[model samples]
Target: MLRVIGKRLLLLVPTMIGLSILLFAWVRALPGGPAVALLGEKATPEAIERVNELYGFDRPWYEQYFIWAGRLLQGDFGTSIQTSRPVVDEFMRRFPATLELSFLALIIAVGIGVPLGYFAARRYGKVSDHASVILSLVGITIPVFFLAFILKFIFAVKLGWLPSDGRQSPRIDATHPTGFYVWDGIITGEFDAAWNAIVHLILPAVALATIPLAIIVRITRASVLEVQNADFVRTGKGKGVAPRTLRTRFIMRNALLPVVTTIGLQAGLLISGAVLTETVFAFPGIGSFLATAIFQRDFPVLQGFIIFIALAYALINLIVDVSYTLIDPRVRVQ
Candidate 1:
């Protein structure tokens, strides 16, 4: 296991380098670069040239990449052109919100999706199974931004049961070491603040959970159904194994393998998908921050977010790979 992990980590280096090159080229391909974004199209030629030089945009592409890469290696993510804030600092500040939202969404997804899928497969060809199919279809079909608005309207605006947006109510001023507001509230023994943060999180989390919930439901149901007729499962039934033990040991354990993979993929997607959810809810997170960076032509922020998200995706895949052995002993040999 250790050797496998080491190998994967080694592979991450070249993968990241390739991604960086692609990212650098991709950002420049976007319409209206930093110079044009900073200085209007009608601005004087000298003014545009000054902005380009200030941001090293006047240099050759390879030189710009090397300089940026060198700074990144030294833990300097560079400064944002829009806010002039350190890119890394800004990412760090907003990431806690993303983490909070993603986690809540994942929890909701797994809590509902897994059980619903299990029961649906168990009751195949029945009303419950058909309902699950319909629900999952609806979930996948719904656009994120549209869902966010609907949820916000039903739960926040019409019901007034939750806040429309933001991480916390303005009334609470809880503080702690970790940037996670809910975590900070707990550690500081401020129950009210923690509860308030959760309240603020509910709508956005639900909105974010829609797609993943549908996916997990489909994956879990399929995996379970496939495993239900496996030779081992049939053999266990023939041996008069207790129903619960047979299902747990032979059915669920094996079925969970694919579900676990789906979950890891969904978790990585939350970072990218949060953009629409954050924008709709006006939630403060890296997704919305990245969106703002793009419109403002903040190359540093754009590059920093892309690299960070890619690195995160790689790490999540590595973790998922390592977990395969734990999920199924048959995979240990591979």
Candidate 2:
């Protein structure tokens, strides 16, 4: 297991480097540099040159990349051209909010998806299975931004039960310093703020969860269906094991490997999917921050955000790979 982990870590180096290069080149190739975006069309050439020089954008592309990469290696992600804040600081400030949102969305997806899949597989070809299939299909078909808007309209505007947008109510005190306002509120005994945050989170989380839930359900159903007919499952049935026991203990144990992998893949999508949802909801998070940076053409922020997301995806896959040994003992043997 240790050797496998070491191998995976070694592989991540090249993967991250490649991702960085691709993202860096792509951002630079975009129409406007950070200076142009910041200075606007009315700015003088001297002003543009000064701005470029200050940000090191006047340097050769390779030299600029080396300087940025060096700062990243030393735990500095450079300053955001738009905000004048350190990229890492801005990211850290907003990342926890996105993480919390994604975590809740994932929980919602799994909580709904796993059971629906299990039942669909058990009922195979029946009405329940058909309904599950239709639900999954609809979940996948709908766009997240549209769903987020519709939810906001129904729950926040029409029903007036939740806030229309944003992370928390302005009336609440933000004295607690943790990045996660909900948790900080809870720790500070601010029930109203915590409740407000949760209510606001519900629509955005549901929107983000839709795709992952659908994907997990479909994958889980297929895996479970395949496992349910295996020789071990047949033997368990023949031995008079309770149907539920046979399904849960024997079938699900094998079926879960694919489901686990699906979940890990979907975990990477959580933050990416949040970009539109967060923007629509005006939630303060890495996604919203990235969107702002994109509009401003803040190359460093854009590059850093892309690198952060790529690292996140790679890290999640690595974790999934390492977990295979626990999920299936056969993995350890190899």
Lowest lDDT sum, 10 consecutive residues, model 2, at: 172-181
Candidate achieving the largest TM-score:
1
137-187 per-residue lDDT for model 1 (tens digits): 999999999999998999888989989999998878788588899999899
Count of clashes, each model? 0, 0
Evaluated against the true structure, the overall lDDT of model 2 is 0.88
Q: Ten-residue segment with the worst summed lDDT in candidate 1?
A: 170-179
In the order shown, the candidates' Cα RMSDs to the true structure are 1.1, 1.4
Name the candidate that leads on lDDT. Answer: 1
